[model samples]
Target: MAILATEGLTKRFPRVTALDELTVMAGTGVTGLVGANGAGKSTLIKILLGLLPPTSGRARVLDLDAATHGLEIRRLVGYMPEHDCLPPDVSATEFVVHMAQMSGLPRTAARERAADTLRHVGLHEERYRPIGGYSTGMRQRVKLAQALVHDPRLVFLDEPTNGLDPQGRDEMLALIRRIGTEFGISVLVTSHLLGELERVCDHVIVIDAGRLLRSSAIGDFTQASQAIAVEVEDGLEPLVERLGGLGEAVAVQGRLLTVQVPADADPGRTYDAVRDAVCDLGLNLVRLEQRRGHIEDVFKEPVA
Candidate 1:
């Protein structure tokens, strides 16, 4: 089922249409909303959350109309805003409890849920420390804990990896993946970094300057293209030689050796050929797979 849908969803600002007549259906799991700074990703999220009224068109969340069922939708959805909004002096526990109460939890339940959620988001003893002393990663966890405090059906994570180092980004991405796989909560995460989302999202929605560009499942989006990713234990030079000898087009980009799978190529025989070639060269086959296109590659292609 399409958990979220929008049709002709337009949002106008004073000088610009932040979201043009956009239409998209986001299914379950993690769907990435990706674009550059002014791509209307934020605008669309605002409209979906009922934080901003659309200039035109309609949208629905979890089958409820965005306009008519805003409160109900809000109750079932969680949001982590991109910018920092935490109180500097408040402890994460105190802050999260307040958020849970705001979500309509009873005071006792809110406190208990807040503690559990904080622990779940990896804030332990330090959760009692004031927010001002928390590192960027800690702050992000605090924000995420609050979002999950109410046990929402879905979460909209706006740049969850922002301000983190490469290590932090990887950990955050893994956590986002676990949110879907372990908890089964739907996630609609937005990020300007296409590559990072490519690693996490089950589906991707690409926008450009307030216009819908593309929306596709991750499987469909990363489908094997012209480049065939080749892997071997060793003797790369020989495999490269023999493939080229057979008049195949091949190139080495970083760790991947991309070869052209012939137009009339037999899919099953292709791997066998690679396997045989590796045996002939006395090399173990490590990885010989298809080269999947990344989300960033979609932009490189001439916009259709």
Candidate 2:
């Protein structure tokens, strides 16, 4: 099912057109909403969630009209805002339980479910501690716990790793993956970093200047293309010269090398030739893999 969708959706804020004729779709699993800052990613998400009415066009959440069915959608969908909104006075246990009860669960059931949700999000004994004493990662988990406390069917995670460290980011990403695969919750996650989303998202939708740039499965971005990526410890100057002399389309990126092979030509021969050249030169072979385009490649020139 299409968990969320928008068609020519637009939003205007006095002088700025936050979103301009934007369209997007989110299916089951994790769909990545990727764009740089001010690229209209947040505006598009808001329109679909019915938080802001679109200036033009249509949007739907789970087949219901975003304009008319917003109330119903709110019950079925969970939203984890990008910014911090935790109450400093209360503990995670208290906040999540309150959120669950507000979602129509009874007090006892709400508290019970809040405890389970907190644990599922990796918050243990510290959950009972006051929010004022929590670290950034702990606070982020509390936010996530509240989002899931109501047992929502679909979720919108807006930069869940925004302020997290490397370790915290990895932990949050794993949690997001599990929420979709293990818990059966469809998710639309946003990130300004294109490469970061590539690691965790099943599909990616790139947007630029409030317009839809491209939308495709992750495989399309990482498919075996005509370019080959070769890496060695050193002596890339000689390798580039040798490969260029041999009439192979080769280029260097940082410590790695990229050799473009012919479409129908045998990659094995190309690989062997590169291997032999490195061996003959007595250079260390670090790695060799096929070169695939990334989300940033979509922006190398134009998204068109």
Candidate 3:
């Protein structure tokens, strides 16, 4: 089932159109919403959460009309905003428990759930320290912990790794993946870094200039190309010429030669041809592998 869906959704702010007839759907898994800084990713999330109304079109979250059932939808959907919104003076446990109680949990249950959620998010003794004293990674975890403390069915995580270092980013990505797979909670995560999402998302939705560019499974986004990349230690020009002479469509990409593998050509024959050409040229084969596409490729095109 689709966790969220939008059709012809657009949002305008006086001089700028943040979203322009945007349409997309997210299912039950970790879905990455990718785009540049001004691509309207945040606007879309706000509309879906009923925090912002679309200028036109329709949207639904968890089968609830975003316009009408926003209260109930917010109750079921957790959101970790991109920016820092934590209270500096409050401890993680205190903040999350307050959030849980605000979400309508009883005081006792809120406290208990907050403790569990904080621990799950990798906040231990530090959870009791003032958020102002916590590192960027710890603050992100506290934000995440509050979002999940309510036992939400789905979460909209905006730039969860925004200020995180490389190690913190990896750890957070692992947590996001675990939330989707182990906890069985659907997640819609946003990031400007296309490659980062490729590592953890089951599906990816690419947007550009406030419009949908492409949406597909991660595997489909990074499918094997018909071309194989070959890198030679030396004499690249000679190898390129030899491969071209053998009827392979070869294109030079930096130090690598990209050879388009013909559909009807035998794999073994192609390998033999490449091997013999390299051997005949006496050049060292540094690497050879089928090149794969990436989600970033979609953004390279003009907006449609």
Candidate 4:
């Protein structure tokens, strides 16, 4: 049930290769395409949308070959480019309606869908105002509204939270989650931010300079580790000394200490050691919890 896939995809320019033998798949639910700027994320999206031709390899969207069936694929897919492309003088409602009609909706149905989509994105009464007068967040909503207006089966959202404030970013992410869950539309969202993707995506694909790094479910990417995170209010040094004497490995980060759970030892014993160490030093225990992995851990050098 892959909504989009690429096999041995490679795109080369005169001076650099944008994508290099990258193979990946995205199924239903929200999937994140994560990488830094110039990582070929945008280039991959363009190829998938059939907007750019790859130098070699194959790409398919909604089971249609991107090279041969681009028009058919575009009809089923919605794309929101990273950069601003909306007309300044056009009202959101008018713009969305035009886009829906362009997607083959009847004029009357287009208008109705435009209103509904704009409202769903939280545009409200401001949707009738010219795009020129809108804030960055409002402009973003307008772009999102048009993408969803045609009721596309899948959407390629390229940095939908770009230029947004914290609150706006949260709102946009929530909206994306709803599109996949409530509206039943598949989503492929691209971003340089890893944590945001971890929050909303069911699966994530990581790439660097157009090369595939890893692809897996969110849970797999952030599994629990064999380490315990401990924090205390005071007596940190004494607690560290006491834990070391009790045969524990400890790494301190400010107020938190991460103690590793020995491979052959019981985790309960490790927990007990930490508790007894804190109690022996008369330090107020703030937190004692098992450490969990994070998407950022992928970029770190593995512990030997």
Please provide TM-scores, in order, for all candidate models, with all chains considered together.
0.79, 0.78, 0.78, 0.78
Give the alpha carbon lDDT tens digit for every residue of 132-219 in model 1. 9999999999999888889999999998999999878888999899887788899999998777787789998889988888888776
Reference-based lDDT, each prediction? 0.84, 0.85, 0.88, 0.88
* Model 3 weakest lDDT span, ten residues long: 219-228
Error of 4 at 50 (Å): 1.0
* 93-153 per-residue lDDT for model 3 (tens digits): 9999999999999999999999999988999998888999989999999999988999999
Which runs in model 1 stand beyond 4 Å of their true positions?
A: 223-295
Name the runs in model 3 displaced over 4 angstroms.
223-296, 301-304
Off by over 4 Å in 2: 223-295, 301-304
In angstroms, how far off is 191's CA in candidate 2? 0.2
Candidate 2, poorest ten consecutive residues by summed lDDT: 219-228
Winner by lDDT between candidate 4 and candidate 1: 4
* Alpha-carbon runs more than 4 Å astray in model 4: 223-296, 301-304
Which tens-of-lDDT digit does each residue in 58-130 have in candidate 4? 9999999998888999999898989999999988889999999999999999999998999899999888889
Compared to the true structure, candidate 2 yields what TM-score? 0.78
